[model samples]
Target chain A: MANAVLTVRGIVRSFGAFRAVDEVNLDIIEGEIHALIGPNGAGKTTFFNLLTGSLPLTEGEIRLRGEVISGLPMDEIARRGIVRSYQISSIFPDFTALANVRFALQRKRGANFDFWRSERSLESLHGRALELLDELGLVEWADVRAGDLPYGRKRALEIATTLALDPQILLLDEPTSGMGREDIGRVVDLIRKVSKGRTVVMVEHNLSVVEGLCNNVTVLARGRVIASGSYKDVASNEKVVEAYLGAAHA
Target chain B: MAGTAFLKTTRTAGVSQSQFLGFTKARAIFFLLFAALIAVGPQFLYPIFLIKVYCFIIFACGYNLLLGYTGLMSFGHAAFFGMGAYLCGYAATQWGLPFELSVLAGTVIAAAMGLVFGWIAIRRTGLYFAMITLALAQMVYFIAMQAPFTGGENGIQSIPRGTVLGFIDLSSNTTLYWVISVIVLAAVAFYNRIIHSPFGQVLRAVRNNPERAKSLGYNVDRFKLAAFTISAAMAGFAASLKTITFGIATLTDVSYVISTEVVLINLVGGIGTIFGPVVGSFFILSLEHFLAPYGPWVLLIQGIVFTVFVLLFRQGIVGELQKRFRTHL
Candidate 1:
């Protein structure tokens, strides 16, 4: 068994009486595409929120490399090599594509608080940002404002931003939630290329996407994991079929 | 990363992909233009009037830092501004400190005050933040009204413009104009440099989305406090310079009107743009000058302008111009 990069044990999140995430346990191992598949409102977002430290866990232990990270702030957790991309493409809209990536690169390089040096002089940081942009096929549009980008491109930028963290583990919320057929293929290719040696856990609804991209799959039904394993193993599970794959079977 | 690039191209393809206003170039040009204008302006215009404009411009710009970059609207900016004027006025008139030293003193005190007030005020957000700041400024106003040294109703009358460096007599309005202009220009330049810096970028990010910024490995609160301190100090600097020019400090400095005026200036010009405060100051000051004979007409005109712009031009003057021109900064 590969070493677990992140472990979530008995995690529960409740909005008053409504349990957004029931006592769910997950161990995402290093260097594997683990897809958290579920129906709409299966608490996928809330679970991702808890994992990324966006929302606090009610009663659970989340460990990154066996270190407790539940009580830490989102930024602190991100700094420790675990980062998540947003579903809504949260980026500095006014900033150039290169500048947005530069910002992410700046954080990873450290020393942004320094008031002395001109930010433009951070040459290495700029170079790294440029390289990352090139890798993402955004080199031509590096100078373009992020806000002006199309929906598909913005989603891609969101992923690129997460990659800038140089994260050992990545939590992606609906990486291809909104994309045209061509863009979806492009995103799948990008994900496959980028996921090499990096641990990726994503919450996606597209079954074909799950079947194609995910090496391991966990089915979340009403905030609980009904079945989890390889795609073929979970596809045959009757409980998962009734709870999540009802429309797929139909 | 590839996704962002594709998005950028597709997005820019729809619109003209020409670079928007480069913030760095715009900032440098703005400070340079102002410095040139102020340096040469007093040669033609009334020196005392120019000095007044300088003071208010600095005051508005300081207010802009809080509202524009940090996304925190303060209704009580006049409180800190007035406090600075009062402190500088008192130090120069009573304690016999050098004009520059008194201004520095005022700035330091204002910064300390900002730290305390910002800590308290920033605890709340949105409308509550505005109310808290206003209430705090009102407290300062009341204190200024009752304090014995503040000269109560009459205020500190006949405050000496004092000898600059205890040598050159500033009794000449022209000489004092130059002095005040230099201070204002410097303050504006400093603000420009700050906004263009990395710190400023982080501030804008924090303003846009505090939670997201925090998640991206930034300490949001620390940035907020730092920005608050810097803004307050700059305001104090402007206030001290104003005292030097006018030779008096009054309750008028801390009045609610001063606070509202600063916000209006920012609103008229453009809240986030570097040139917004300067442009807004000139327009408002010129309006006030033109309407001197009309009394309440100035208020009426200002109110109309505020309403029209708030409803019609959400981006303010400079922001709208940038949008139209497709400049990126």
Candidate 2:
């Protein structure tokens, strides 16, 4: 197996008396696409949030290549090359698809505080931004305001922007969520294409997408991992089956 | 990389686009003539009146920078504006500093205030941000009322406009108007450049979706704070220009009433459009000036205009024009 790119150890996030993410331990292997699947409120999303540093870890630590990264701010984590896509499509609605990708590219060139200077440097980022759009099959929607794009195209644009960051490890939170079956296939293909040469950890609800694209499958239930292995191994696990289908169906 | 096909619709041939007004050679020349007309405005109109209008235009523009562009609504803009006036007045009348130094001092101090207020205010979003700014500005108002250097209720009067470069007398209204016009025009140009700059694009990203911005490796709060500082300093610069020109720094400059007026100026002109606040300033000020003969009915008329705008013309005049014409301005 590839070396562990990210290691999570007994991480806990508690709100008052409730533990949204409790004692979650995960190992995300490099150069692999890992699927995190669970029922509603299984803490999969919360766990992703903790990895990206969006939520503070209450009792454990996350390490990138064995170095601690849990308590850093979201932006700092991103700067360190751990980038994520939201469960809901998140792009700058008022900006065009091209502009959205260009803004994401701003991370490569420093986003400094110099209002007096012209943003002429941004013009340099245009070429790469368009390339990402083309790769996402969003070239036809490039000039369209992101808010006006069709749902599938908007989702494509969001992924394009995420790709613009050129992250070492990408976290996709339900990349195919709300997508039509046809669009889901397209996104799965897109994710497969982009997952090369880097690690990807996805919290996916669709098991078929997981089975088709992921190198490993980790099943979660009620804030705990029930099973983790190859798709076939996890599929046959009694606990994963019980958690997914309920005890009666299992 | 913007999908080449759809980008064609938003950006057509021979039409450049930007956050502010985008123009071609013909339009650029037309704008030049327009500037010439405003420069020679004192020839046909009262120089001080035009100066007053220009100053308010800058103030409104400054207010719009934070609200329209960055989507930050601040009701306490009066604090920066008023303090700039008071500081410039104090530096000029009390310390006998040069006009340039006095203006600089005011701008820097107001920017510093912006840093503090923005650091605190940006910790909250939307309504909370507005309220925090309002509360902070009210505190500034109270301080202005009680400050001993501010001449209590009367304010600082007879602030000499002083000579430019220690030679050309600013006492002459025409020369003063010309000097002030040069400065105001430059400030406006700077303002235009800022909104079209790279920082502005990042600011819009922050305004558009701060969460996404943060996840994209942008320190969102830092951008917000930077935008706020620049905006506050610009407001201070406008206030100083007005105080130095009018020869007085009054309590009215710092009052909440002025703060609300700045908001009205933006609302009527167009919130985020290039000429929105500029046109709004001239229009609203003229309304107040020329319509005073109608007594209390003038206020009633103003109320009607505002209500009509809020209900039907929410984008304001320039935003509407920009949308209809598909132009940047």
Candidate 3:
């Protein structure tokens, strides 16, 4: 906890009578790829939403670099270096892959309000956007519309946009969801490469991906964290086995 | 071969760089042609009809800023347009303000209305947003009906054409025509600048995906509010110009019918394209002018035209042209 870049304590999100995320606690250390895994209806996405400020928490505190950001708006939270990507492919469909990245860079550079200047004048930002696309192996897809890209490439483009923000902490919800095995492997590698020198808290359903990439894993079941530790430790935990892996195998 | 090569070289050399105020070389040429048309238009066409077309073109362009670019369909734009007319008329008649200041007053008032209405309405989206705007516009219509300075049902009539900049007596039709043409052209150019600016990019991004734009650290509501205010201000500018041209501000200008008409104009022209509103304004205005003698049949004809456009040319005339040409017209 001493090196924790993001700390979530007693985070609770209740929808009417249903407690979607109940009293969760987590500590994400700097430069760690931490995974949140759970069976369907186990509150993984809700917990992710709570952490990203996409949903209001019923009760809890979220601190980023020791600053309380529990109730801040999503954009404000992103501005404070906690950016998130959706479980679905969330890149702007109509925008070219290059433009998708440039928009994020534009926000990072505080050039969003430059209404009088030509968009071409923002060409300086394109270098960085292209760099991000190149980093994600999307340089070939740069001019292609994000919506027109194949599913795997669209996920990669989404990551490229997320990276453009230069976030200190990145939350990715199901970054490899709906991808084929080959695409999944590519994205797993993409995530590992991009997590260098940055903190990532991802909601991943692929156990192999978690084992291969995550430094630590948190298992949630019935809206509560049932186990948390190294992948080996949490995977073998009797409660996690009973609640998630047991159900998966059954 | 040498002669052909020389011709090609000269053509390329004569082509202007695409960096002139964000317009491409082709677009710049198109703009020049457009300017020429505007310059010579009044001579051939009915000058008064041309003035009306320009006013609606400005109004539709302003409406498009929100509906077309920002993806917000406001059904209450007449509130801004009508407010501009009434406010400008009042300023000219009551305060005896010059032409320019009266227009300025109208524009500022409409912008202020936009700020307030946008704040309240942007909390909702889609049909809810449209309905809120429609309700607010109706409230404005009621205010216009009962307000004493607005001349009630009779409306503000016979507004004087005050001198521009304390000179250039606007009494002459030709002089006023030139002035309106210049103002309309400048506004269109300004709109073009905005559509190609970083702010416009962000607005489009917000329109495409509000959630993604927010995740990128943009305050989406703030951007929407800004677009709404700017759109309202432009609509107000158009309204004031119309009032000055006709020397009257009527309740019909602020009515719900006017709001729907502007939406129709944008739809018929092209919702998001830069010149769509201009094409739509001319098309609709020409229809109205030509069908004036048809009496009640005009409404039937207009309805049929709208239905056909929606069914066959939903992207609109300009949108269809842009699609076919593979260019951003």
Candidate 4:
């Protein structure tokens, strides 16, 4: 097992009588692309929410580098270098693409409190921002309003916004949910490039892309992990086959 | 590290781009020239009228700071403005504090008032927030009406316009005008600084997508609170100056009507435009003075103007000019 950047142990989240996320334990190592896969309503996003501190854990300890971050506020968690991207693209729609990214970057740089100083002097922030745009192939649409962008581009921009936070661990919920084949390919490539040397935990449904990208895969069904292993191992397991592939195979 | 760096860089770019779009040297130049005009205008125009206009401009600018850039509509701004006026009026009259010190006291009090109101009201969003603030302000207005220091129905009258810097007698309308102009200029510059700074970007970000801003690591509540405080102080500063200039402060300063009037001025000028409030203040003040001869007809005309501005001219006068000029500034 590689060194875990984030560790979730005995985590359970519930609402009333329903257990949205049952006792779940997970570990994400540095520089690993860990794929979280499950059917709709399988508590995947709920788990993501808890991991990112958007929701409180009913019973668990979540640690970032051995520091407990179970119920910290979302912003505080984010400030500690853990951030998340939403399934629905949440961005500053009226702002230009670059502007949305810049907002996050400014937060990271502590340029926000100085009222008299012009932000233009933050050259390194700008230069690095443009470079990120270039990397995401958003250089052409840098000036476009985020709202005006196509769905795929908006998703890409959401990711770009998340990346600007310089998170040590990125929890992405449906990074390519509404993407076309061409966009999916481009996004997958960008994800690969962006996730280099950082831990990425994503909830991706596309099996092929999951297979191509994720080094480790965790599968959930009915609010509990049914199987978790290498794609080959999980795909070949009898329980996994009975739970997922058997329905299709039959 | 790559993903982290990528996210950080993208955020910076977005902020830099927004800063470039709305903030420019052209806007700065316009403000500088406008301040110069205000500074020297008492040489010709009636200093009393100019001071009144200056006060209104500050009120409009303060109100717009929340509504325009932060996208938060506050209906209770009159509470802060009135509170400042009453404080300045009471302090100068009763305590016999120095002129600038009294005004400063008013601003500090207003900021504290804003903090309390913001803490409670910000728990709600959109129209609910507006309503909550309005209710709170109405409570304040009633208190001001009944408070002993406020002189109840009559309000604090015959306020002393204490000498500026303990030397220059502000008894002269021209001297008072100069003092008001200097304060107004400083307030406008402060506004410009805040809206163009990185803090402004965060406000706009929260304005655009608060949930997104929170997930991206900003303490969104802090930004909102700070904005509320600064805005309240500016409004209070204006009111304080008005109290000193006019040598009186009354319930009129704290009324819902005054609140609506500030909004009207901003709406008539432009919401987001920096110099719009100054232009709007002058336009509306002149119209009011010119039509005073007609009594109630003046309000009727003002109502008609308000309706016209709301229905047909949403972008306002300066906004329209900026559009025509195709200049972002």
Q: Enumerate the candidates' DockQ scores in order.
A: 0.30, 0.57, 0.36, 0.41
- Residue B49 of candidate 2: its Cα lDDT? 88
Question: Model 3 lDDT vs. the true structure?
Answer: 0.87
Task: For residues B100-138, write the lDDT of model 4, one tens digit per residue.
Answer: 889998888899999999999888889999899999999
For residues B1-329, write the lDDT of model 3, one tens digit per residue.
22332322222211123555467665566567778989989778988889999999889988998999999999999999999999999999999899999999999999999999999999999999999999999999999999898998888988899898888999998999999988888878888888878899899999899999998889999999999999999989999999999999989989998999998899999999888898899998899999999888878988998999999999999899888987776
User: Arrange candidates by lDDT, highest first: which order?
Assistant: 3, 2, 4, 1
Residue range B39-129, candidate 2, lDDT tens digits: 6787788889889988998888788888888989998889999999999999999899998899888888889999999999999999999
How close to the true structure is residue B328 of candidate 3, measured as C-alpha lDDT? 72
TM-score sort, best first: 3, 2, 1, 4
- Name the best candidate (by DockQ): 2
Q: Mark the regions of model 3 whose C-alpha exceeds 4 Å error after superposition.
A: A180-186, A247-250, B1-17
Question: Quick one: ranking by DockQ, best first?
Answer: 2, 4, 3, 1
TM-score of chain A of each: 0.94, 0.96, 0.95, 0.93
DockQ of 2: 0.57
Which regions of candidate 1 are displaced past 4 Å?
A114-117, A122-124, A246-250, B1-33, B163-168, B323-329
Q: List the residue pairs that clash in candidate 2.
A: A119-B198, A130-B1, A139-B3, A142-B3
Index of the highest-lDDT prediction? 3
Cα error, residue B93 of model 1, in Å, equals 3.0
Error of 1 at B135 (Å): 2.5
lDDT of every predicted structure (CA atoms): 0.80, 0.85, 0.87, 0.83
Q: Against the true structure, what is each candidate's TM-score?
A: 0.90, 0.94, 0.94, 0.89
Error of 4 at B266 (Å): 2.0
Error of 1 at A241 (Å): 0.9
Interface RMSD of each: 5.8, 3.8, 9.8, 5.4
